[model samples]
Target chain A: MGTVSTVLSPPALRTGMALAGAGFRRWATYRQAMLAGAFTNTVFGFLRTSVMLAVAAGAGGVAAGYRGPQLATYVWVGQGLLAVVQLWGWTELSDRVRTGDVQSDLLRPVHPVLSYLAADLGRAAFALCSRFVLPMVVGLIAFDLYLPHRPATYPLFLLSMLFATVVSFGVRYLVNLTAFWLLDIRGVIMAWLLCSNALTGMYFPIAFLPGWAQAVLWYATPFPSILQAPVDVVVERGTAGHQATVLAVQGCWAAVMLAAAVVVQRRAERRLVVQGG
Target chain B: MADRPTTAAAYRALLGAQLRAQTQYRFSFALDTAASALITLLDVVSVLVLFRVTPALAGFSFTDSLLIAGLANAAFQLCDMCVGNIDTMREYIRTGRFDAVLLRPLRVLPQLVFGDFSPRRIGRAAQALVVLVVALSLADVTWTPARTVLVVIAPLSGAVIFGAVFVAGSTTAFWFVESGEFANAFTYGGRDFTIYPVGIYPGWFRAVFAYSLGFAFVAYFPGLALLGRPDPLGTPGFLPWCSPLVAVLAATAAALVWRVGVRHYRSTGS
Candidate 1:
């Protein structure tokens, strides 16, 4: 009874710990890969800073709501936060579905969706540590990167990042699920990527957007709550409350996406007939 | 030159087979194309919206930025379609299917080129045309023979240069199998950096492009010609129309690296 009861507890938590362990194992083996990734990211961060500085140059005191040093701080914070948020690499579950490896996953007592999410969170967290953190530290040394002043910002920033990760993971999960229903998902994935890039402000700051665009972002997508909100908290330490509100918005969005994913996965599983020898 | 016609016919046959295989699920293909078109359209829209926020970006007006963006989109899509096979070559190499191409009668390059043709690239290309049209309408350029020639050659040469970059990147599979990820940075990441004018970058970044292999062809010189702006890099007048020259050089570079890669593949037998 004890063994079975322990097994029957929430699959997400049990699988989450197991998957996180697996992530750590993978990280150990792929240390070199992660280091290389960090180096590449640091190089790009420098390039991006140059572009922003060029744009903000010739202006008097403040350009795009940031002074020179503060703007540098924003870029460093954004890059560091990128690890905690973890945006790159999509189509994990979809590839499994396509290759028919998902058969074993479906047989588990834990829902395949939850299992996949747990596993992804594990892998992404490892990548974040090895890739994002290391690079940002190097960037801080080389570029005189600034950190947030107030102590309160750290806790709120962590909270915001966690919320952002959940929301982003949910979005990616749902996007991957579409491959189960659709025969060719590359185009759809590409299109989704384009939207996510705009919404998440991967290319630029959300503050750079126009009023109508900002309104559209708030209502139409959960993008602003992801990268932009977390970075906002870092740059403006006093705005932790606003960041918390954004985190709340992100939680709601996550719940909505998770619900949608469950429904879709159920429907797709019923129709899923993997035809092979 | 002797086998050009036959090679062309063979390429068409391969393309037809690939398209039909894709079209087997017609509804999915149609839906994907529509969705992709919408998504790409939104990306352009986002840029326009950003431009509306501020009258200028790094001293570039909305219309000028649109022109640069349109050209980049068109060039990238064309390259994507042509070398779509190379993008997946690492998988083929890992699975040992690359040997099958080596065993074929035709040249390895032609066989590779004909291997894959993603129809979705057309969606990207079409979206780029819409961007170009909008930019043209906004600009007050009097359409002349010279302008038409510049526009036509600009995207074509840009595609060639970009395709060469992919080929060079894909050839790196010969040296480091896992280097595919980093190879992507130079092509896709480089395209992003180049979409804006070279002048916007720092002196060091500009120096890399000036000295780097693929940068001049992809965006630097041709963009100057297309924009009709004085060469920010102090390039000569004739250098602006140096697209074809860049294309030839890139192709030569790709061919040489690919030849060396083929030798490596033979020796490893993997």
Candidate 2:
């Protein structure tokens, strides 16, 4: 236990990096699966782009703040980020908790939340390189996409993506932690998956939603930061100052969600201890 | 041989057992039903948002598009209720549990279909039915007796078409255990593709889905016939009635593929 404290204090950074590297290597081994996934994403990208472009064309080249080319960019970029943020179909942590394997994870020296977050970052890193870049390249060839010329826009977009990954990981961790109380969290997770996919601007732009719904989503959920903010920065929808503001808000949400995850994990661990797990 | 039950009786018994097993977890089943229904609602809402922004899709009015989406949803859900379990065929094949299925007295495909008979999926079907009713009320088409019959039979034919796709996809598991995701591009992706008027898509896309995949026969052609609208892309006037034939042909092809796959599995023992 004394070694656990020492390991937590100074060398935690090293452990985190090692875990991330391991995660990257683990996912990279599924080369065939990755290619198939990339292909599927690209196919769906064309479907979505067709729909959006059709709507815009029907409306005489503008609908809900999007022109034909802008809508295409939104669709393809959203498809790319979908794999990067991984908004659904992850059940590893909750499955572990249900089967009592989470106890082993708790017994490890490192904090479980930090370990999962690090691993998720590595997965996100890999997805960005493979899944993310593939769709964007296809989009570039298939359609006219918006590219921001401002130098600051590129760095800010990257920062927004990093924050988006963090926010997504935090929300997923919190959802999985509900297993401490509910024996079967699958239903809850399913409901969450449906909501997040719609609300996270993956299915369509958040602005296309009704005004009241958009306002509620903007203020109440951290979903838009996951996809919309970064894509908006890349597309240069708003001014540079506005882009900075979006990044700042995204960063803040990520920090707050990560903090909430830590607090929830602590409470869950105490409950587990009380129950003699 | 004298004690053997009829095939119909065997199927009924299998479905009865499945219902009993499913009802044993009543609370979880209810939750899952609601969740499935809610997920289906998202697609409707997405379509609604699109229509809210634009008056028409390609040339179809909002109500017309709604009718297309609703009929497509109803058809897909009906097929999904009966055959969606094919999505898990790979797991059974991988664990060698499929051999037990093959050894049973009943036919393998019927048993597989009945084995996963889920009452919970009725929730999605029910929602689609409601959408269909709403679309029928809103769309300006005159509902003649012939048109009404077409509307009623459309979903059934659509179910057969989608079921054929599911069977074909699952049969691939015998050759490639990890083909589930690839199969999804056909079954699930096909459903997504049919929700819109096929004419709005690019030329190549329309060609593939309409001619190659036969998805056009699923909803688009039938929808035009029911609505009394001509095909904007100049398809034949008689094409709408070809949906049933296309569905039967697809199912026949799927049955042949399943036979080949089963033969291969027996020879390779994998």
In order, candidate lDDTs are: 0.69, 0.82
Instruction: Give every collision pair in model 2.
Output: none
Candidate 2 per-residue lDDT over residues B61-109, each given as its tens digit? 8888888888888889999888888887777887788888889988888
lDDT of 1 by residue, B1-270 (tens): 778898778889988998888788766677667776766565456456545445555666677767776677677777776775687876667667788888877787767777777677776787777777787687555566776887888778778878888888887767765553656666765666656656666677567754465565565565556667776567678877777778788888888887888888732355
Best by lDDT: 2
lDDT of 2: 0.82
Steric clashes per prediction: 0, 0
> How does model 1 score on DockQ?
0.32
Taking the tens digit of each residue's C-alpha lDDT, what string does model 1 give over A1-277?
4644654577646776897678566655766456545655665676566656655563543555766566666666666656555565677678877887777788887777666666666766776667667866866776655577888878877777777777777777877787777746765676666666667866677667767877788656877776777777766633656656666777787777777777889888986757454
Q: List the TM values for chain B, per candidate.
A: 0.86, 0.91
Q: What does candidate 1 score in Cα RMSD to the true structure?
A: 3.8
Q: Which stretches of model 2 miss by more than 4 angstroms?
A: A1-10, A271-277, B1-30, B94-100, B103-106, B266-270
TM-score of chain B of 1: 0.86
